[model samples]
Target: MLLAVEGLTHRYGDKTALDQFTMHLNRREIVGLLGPNGSGKSTLLRVLSTLVKPQTGRVEICGFDAGKLPEAVRSRIGVVFQTPTLDPLLTVEENLLIFGSFFGISGRALHERVRHLMQQFGILDRRTDFAKTLSGGLRRRAEIARALLHEPQLLIFDEPTSGLDPAARDDFWKAIEELREKRSTAILISTHLFDEAERCDSLILLHRGLRVAEGTPAELKATIGGQIVELVAKKPEAALETLRAKFGAAIELSDGILRVEAKDAHQMIPSLVEALPGEVLSVGLHQPTLADVFRKVTA
Candidate 1:
């Protein structure tokens, strides 16, 4: 196991940030900490990265206890924070070399490692450019390369693609996939984006500092099995009551929209339209998605 966390709990004053969270990851596995902001994803990442001591629970990384052997754990894991870390004044190659030096790597070894990582992340062509001169996507790639300079077995990313265009985000993920295949590194990333969560091998969904759900994307979506029928009603409250009477508790109202879950949702559309008459403004039917699953589990 590359990473293992059990009964992890933390607090800030009176507010709890994480509660009895437990999960594990292995080499070559991509695990996502899926949640919205303030969902304890960042807290958990801090604890695992050995920056924050866990008030309770055990965090073991690559056979090293995070609390007891933080230095050891730190040496074996790389962290890419949510915010940019590169020095704007330094060139890309210079930034990597400086970070590598901090890890006690220097001279020919550091130079070789920086070169390899730049090439691997497709930032070799931009090495001579100052950090401030690179685009958002190129800067991000440099940061990831810097994190891997020491070749850590596990990589921890906190909202890695938080501020990038769609194309840059896609490119970032492709690099991550290639890294896993080539280095067999274990990745534990925190992300709120549904598309990014869908790409993970498995996901642990957190909501308000609690573990709401945990499984593969397919498994989580399966929990909301069948189809989801959504419609905006002219009279939302009245339509909700009407739909509830006909569809039971499966019918719910959110944001002035009526949602119904059923095995044969398409067949129910006509019935729903007839029941509401002119009350429904529009209707849509689709299979379950990560967003739907999150809404259901959090609801």
Candidate 2:
């Protein structure tokens, strides 16, 4: 395993941040760490990258123990933190040079590395531009490039595209895809967005401090089975509990919207109209999405 974590546990005083987490990543695999707030996804990344100490369990990245061999582990893994770390006063190239120095890289070699990374990210034109002047997407690309200066086999990104616009997000993924093609880099990505998870080779969905489910996007979606029935109701909140208790595991509530995985939503419509305060606004029968499976698993 390129990255292996087993029975990992972490705590802050009496509160548990991670509870018995177990997962792994192979070379060239992109694993998405997905969860709601405070679900331990970030905590897992912190431990794997050697930024935080775990109360229990082991993290072996590229055969080096993260806790026991801190220097060796840090040398092999690259991290792009969720918070902004780039200096606003420094230009993109300058930032890369400064970070590359940490890896004992400098002179022509470091410049060449920065050039290659900026070209890969399509930011060579902005190499001299200060990070503060770059768009959200460009800054993210720079940050990722900075992380890659040492040519680490594994790359960790936390909420990489959280505030990016649509075009920039697409551009970021394009860069990552190119990175995957060129280096076959094992990427560990943490994100709250389901669409972001879809881009990964596999996903681990979490709630609170536990891993609720983990698999390929297709495998996770397959957990729900059959078609999803979206019930457009007039009184969604009021009707949700009744439908769920009646429909059991098939029913789901999101905002005023309701979803049920059933073979025959059309057949069930008449009954809903008669009992519900409003007529059926609409009913959609479609294949279950990753979100649907996540809902069922996390509910």
Candidate 3:
């Protein structure tokens, strides 16, 4: 294991942030921490990256105990926070140079490393541009480039694609995939986006400061074992109660829509429609997705 978290627990005043959370992370695998807001994803990242110490538990990164040997753990991991850390006044190359210096990287070696990383991120052409002038996507690429300057073994990103448009998000993920192939480094990213979570090799689903489930996306979705039925109904609450009572279905009202998980849902759809009659405005059935899996586990 490249990373091991054992019985980690953290609390803030009256509320618990992490409750005996534990997991193992393999080298070169992309593991996503998937959760809604306030799910302890950020707290876990903070603990893993040594920004904050957990009240209890052990975190070993690259064989170094994070609590006792933070410097060693810090040397082997790169972190990209949800907020950009680039100085707006500095050019892309300057920002990378400053970050490289923190790792005692200087002179010709730093230059070559910066050049290589810039090329890898497709931002070599933008190296001379001030960070404030770059678009959101370009700035994100620059942030990633800076993070890789030291060639850390583990890279951590917290909602790296947040606030990006579809095209920018696509570009950012392409860069991540390219880096994964080129570096063969372990990656851990926290995200609430289903599309982003689906790209990970494994997932840890968190809810209200506890780990709810963990598996590959396909494996997690397989736990549902059938189709997901979503109904936009005129009276979703009533429909949900009626359906759950009549069919004993696993159902709920989310975003004013009735959602259900059923075996062979396509075959049962007609009956559901017939039974609901005028209550349902529209219905949709599909294979269980990461979103469905999240709902099932979190619920």
Candidate 4:
């Protein structure tokens, strides 16, 4: 196991940030922490990164107990935080060198590592460019490369693609996938984005400081066990009432939209339209997705 967390819990005075969370990760596996805001995703990452010690339970990284051997854990793990960390005034190469120097790497070894990482991440051409001059995607790539300079076995990222455009996000994930394949690194990513969560090998879904569900993306979606029928109604409340009378608990009202989950939902559409009788402005049906799984588990 590259990372092992057991019965982890943390609290902030009256608020419980984490509650009996347990998970294990293996080498070269990508596991995503999927949750909404205030769901303890950040708190979990903080504890794993050793920035915040867990109030109870154990966190072992690369065979080192985080509480007993924080330095060892830190050395074995690399973290890329949600916010930017590079110095805008420094060149990309300068930023990486400075970060590596903190790990006591220097001279020829440091230079070679930097060159390899930059080349691997496709940022060597931008090595001389100031951090402020790089685009959001390039800066993110540089930061990931910097994190790997110390050759940590585990890489932890917290919403690493935040604020990036779709194309940039795609490029970032491509690099991450390549890194895992080539280095056999274990990765833990915390994200609220559905697309990003879907790319993980498995996911731990959290809600209000508790683990709500855990499984591969396909497994979780399969738990929903049906199709989703969504409609925007002309009179949402009335439509909801009408639908509820027919579909019972299978139908729910969210954001002024009526959603129904049923086996073979496509066959139900005609009945739904007839039941609502022009109240629905538009309707759509699709297979269950990660978003649907989240809604089901959280609801």
Question: What overall lDDT goes with each candidate model?
Answer: 0.89, 0.82, 0.87, 0.89
Candidate 2 local lDDT, 1-299, one digit each (tens): 78888999898888788899899998878999878778887788888888887679988889988888888988878899888889999999999999999889989999898998888767899989999998877888888778888878888999887667776678778767766778777899998788888989999988878999989999998777677778887778767777766667566778677777766665766665565656468777678888787777666
What TM value does model 4 have?
Answer: 0.93
Error of 2 at 189 (Å): 0.9
- Measured on C-alpha atoms, candidate 1 has an lDDT of 0.89
lDDT of model number 3? 0.87
Candidate numbers sorted by TM-score from highest down: 4, 3, 1, 2
- Cα lDDT of model 1 by residue, 1-299, tens digit: 98899999999999999999899999999998877778888899999999999899988999989999999998889999978889999999999999999889989999999998898777898999999998877888889889989878999998788767776677678877877999899999988789999999999889888999999999999998789999999899999898888778888888888898888888999999999988889999999999998888767
lDDT for each residue of candidate 4 in 1-299, tens digit (9 for 90 to 100): 99899999999999998999899999999999988888999999998999998789989999998988899888788999988889999999999999999899999999999999898777899999999998888888888889889877899998888767676677677777777988898999998889889899999999999999999999999998899999999999988888888778788888887888888999999999999776879999999999999987777
Q: Specify the highest-TM-score model's number.
A: 4
Off by over 4 Å in 2: 241-249, 277-279
Can you tell me which runs of candidate 3 are displaced by over 4 Å?
164-183
TM-score of 2: 0.90
| Per-candidate alpha-carbon RMSD to the true structure | 2.0, 2.2, 1.9, 1.8
Question: Candidate 3 — number of clashing residue pairs?
Answer: 0
* Candidate 2: C-alpha lDDT: 0.82
